[model samples]
Target: METNEPNDGHAGNPFTQVPIEITISVGRARPLVRELLRLKRDAVLPLDRRVDDPVELYVGDKLIARGELTELEGDATGQLAVRLTEVADLRDGL
Candidate 1:
């Protein structure tokens, strides 16, 4: 049986603490089969996007947001991060 119980907040949700992985898609490469097979160490595979192009963030197969790649400063210097530029309306679902 199902009942429409009164909802409080995230504290009552079991999935609140569940971990999910978000993938940041920078760009794609479409190398030919022969070209792919000829790849070796130190070979540069060029992508379709420039360095400053916006990257897409995806949760599974769903695109959630778009952002730009940036480098961290301070104690976490050298670490790469994303600066969100656009976010999708996810009120309906993921």
Candidate 2:
């Protein structure tokens, strides 16, 4: 076996700088609009999806992951995460 040395040739860690974005999709808007138009001062518009539905996570307009909205130590969080889909790997041939 040969000893390995630290490779200082790389500029930086790619994983460390990976950008991530999270977004929430409430529901459709056509019925919501009609309901809003008929509402009074105090009104509520019920969403089509449940609270435990999966929320989308994207990376630069590409869908990458999904998870449920949750709370962590009193702070809202997304737990039970899952990487549902990913865009084509751009760095494969580069």
- Per-residue error (Å), model 1, residue 41: 0.4
Candidate 2 to truth, TM: 0.45
lDDT of each: 0.92, 0.55
In angstroms, the error of model 2 at 16 is 6.4
Question: Where's the lowest-lDDT run of ten residues in candidate 2?
Answer: 85-94
For residues 37-84, what per-residue lDDT tens digits would candidate 1 score against the true structure? 999999999999999999999999999999999999999999999999
What residue runs in model 1 are displaced by over 4 Å at the alpha carbon?
1-9
lDDT of 2 by residue, 1-94 (tens): 3337465554456874576565545354456566767988776666667766766665566655466655553343544334343344445521
Native-structure RMSD, model 2 = 6.9
